[model samples]
Target chain A: MKYILSFVLNGQPVDVLAEPTDTLLDVLREKLRVMSPKRGCDEGDCGACTVLLNGEPVRSCLTLALSVAGQEVMTVEGLSKNGKLHPLQRAFHEHYAAQCGFCTPGMILAAKALLDKNPHPTREEIVEAISGNLCRCGTYQEVLEAVQAVARGEYAEVKE
Target chain B: MGECIYFAPTEIGEAVRLLAEYREKVTVVAGGTDLLPKINYYQLKPEVLLHIGRLGLDYIKEADGKLVIGAATPTSKLASNPLVAERASALAEAARQSGSAAIRTTATIGGNLANASPAADLATPLLILDAELLLTSTRGNRKVAINDFFVGPGKTVLEPDELLIEVSLPHQKGKSVFLKLGRRKAMTLSVVNVAVRLEMEGAQCKDARIALGAMAPVPLRCTRAESLIKGQVLDKSLIDRCAAEAVAESSPIDDQRATSWYRKKAGTVLVARALARAADMEG
Candidate 1:
């Protein structure tokens, strides 16, 4: 039941041996050793396992590993360039958006997916984009401020 | 637990052929929003996982005086498509309120209908739009009215070998609105949802359709309530009566989302509001 699943991972091509039942989240965290995407609910209800599939946010836990063949997958590890933090990451750091740091990865990726498509999202749009992600530490206010700061072009130079 | 075979078909013909070959053993997954939860929880163990996302069924177009939507079309596309918004505003609204942005990106209309949840956000709107589903198989294709599609909660009339290929909506002259009273604004199932469509000729209602969700074993069309307003001028009193009738037609059950009693009260109010909005009435 194991198959060679080939895909573009964070701008690089990868081929992993995975079972048909293996979820993209499992392959990334276990098989491929990319640990940004976490498995919280295992079900799609909780957005802890969210990652960008083809530049759009999706539930990695719900996505079959084999189904992502020949598609682009992006995790938080793929965010930075030249060993520098992406603007969103810098904003989150400066704004103290991470307390427990569990939902931070998924939250940042979700916001990145939103900003990539729409650079100037409104406060409401920012909320809608990350509504699926649940931060148990109750860091939503800080998360909002961080994302809003990025939208305001405060970290425009840091973006790559 | 046996090994599961995964098949991602790039062509519609191949997809249907796989369905025909595997029959009931194949679990068709598009978004995996619904199916994956079962699989992950070990509630469903299928011998085959047939992925039809790349079968080129994602489209929205007008043909033969009807709006044809590919079954595999994502909910996010439906929510944003100009044609769907212009022609099926209620459906667009329903799609927009379906799930969070992440879930909506993957969830398909076909998967939504085929899953047959009583609280399916798309069902009530499609019912009011008088949509028809085209189910295809190796045998052939057959169209089923949206009303006749649902068998019960978590069940549909789709045969084991059949695939829902398309959903078509005929031209309708009406102002329609969909309302959902969920636990929260986003990422929640409907406590009670309603969609109402009113084709008005000046002051009189030319035709009317009312559909309710989560208040019955299936997403239900309120024919009796719709008949009350048809060919009559919609007034506050008549709309109230129609709302009551719609709730009366539903046999709600108590669940985690809501109680049957609460659903009756909320369903009535939601239907009345949807009716008033569709008819361009006030209060």
Candidate 2:
């Protein structure tokens, strides 16, 4: 049942052996040892397992590994460059957005997906964009503020 | 874990052939938003998972006076496509309201219909649009009306060898609106959803279609309500009567989402609001 999956992980091409039933989240976290994407409510209801598939946010839990065989995938670990934290990551830290830090990766990545398309999103747009991501710690306002800060050019520089 | 075989076909012809060969042993997964969840829950256990993602079926085009949406077209496309928004606003609204941004990005229209959930949000809007599904097999392709596609809850008339290819509907001349009442604002299934499309000529209603979801075993078009409102002038009393007819047509059941009685009453209110919205009237 194992198949060789050739996909672009972050910016590099990766060939990982995975089973047909294995999800992208499973392969990313277990095989590749990329632990940013967490499995929460593996049914796709909770956005804890969200990752960008070809620049669009999707439920990695519901996505079969075979489906992403020839696609590009980006996890929270890939958000930064040259070992520096991405703007969203810096904003999250500065604004105290990661209350429990469980949903932070998914939330920040979801915001990245939104900001990539609409860099100047309004408050309402930001809320709608992150509606899929659930924050059990009730840090929605903080997350919103962090994303808004980045959109406002406050967190434009990469952090050390 | 080792029991299932995943087949990702690069060609549509091969996909059809594979389906014909496997029959009941295979299950087609387009977006996997619904199917994978069901599979994870052990609710469905098909031996083979046929992935039709690369079949070149994802498209939204208009030709020959009809808007044709390829089966693999994701809900996000439906929500953003200007053609769909202008020609079929109800469908656009329904697609936007169906799931969260992540779910909408991946879930395809084909998967939404083929899954045949009674609470399917797209069903009501598609019903109001009088959508026709293009079901394909190795034998050939056939276009079936949306009304005849559903059998019951989580069931459809799709054969094991058939794959839904396209959804086609004419450009209707009217105002249409879709509304759903759910427990939460987002990421929740509808308790009772209603879609209404009405053609108005001055003060008289020329034609109308009333479609309700999660109110029956399958999403149902309220023919009685349609008949009642069609050719009738806009009025509060007539709208109330039409709403009552809509309630009478559906057969809701008690579930975690809502009670049968709540669905009946709330369905009536939503239907009346949709109808009034279609007529550009206040309810």
Error of 1 at B153 (Å): 1.0
Off by over 4 Å in 2: none
Give a tens-digit lDDT track for model 2, residues A97-130.
9988999889988999999999999999999999
Kindly report the docking quality category of candidate 1.
medium
**Judged by DockQ cut-offs, is candidate 2 incorrect, acceptable, medium or high?**
medium
Interface RMSD for candidates 1 onward, in order? 0.9, 1.1
Per-residue alpha-carbon lDDT of candidate 1 for residues B1-283, written as tens digits (9 for 90 to 100): 5898989988878988999898989999988888888888889987998998888899999999999999999999999999999999999999999888889989999999999999999999999999999999988999999999999999999999999989999999999899999987688889999999999987799999999999999999999999988999878999999999999999999998889999999999999999889888965
DockQ of each: 0.80, 0.79
Clashing pairs in 2: none
Clashing pairs in 1: none
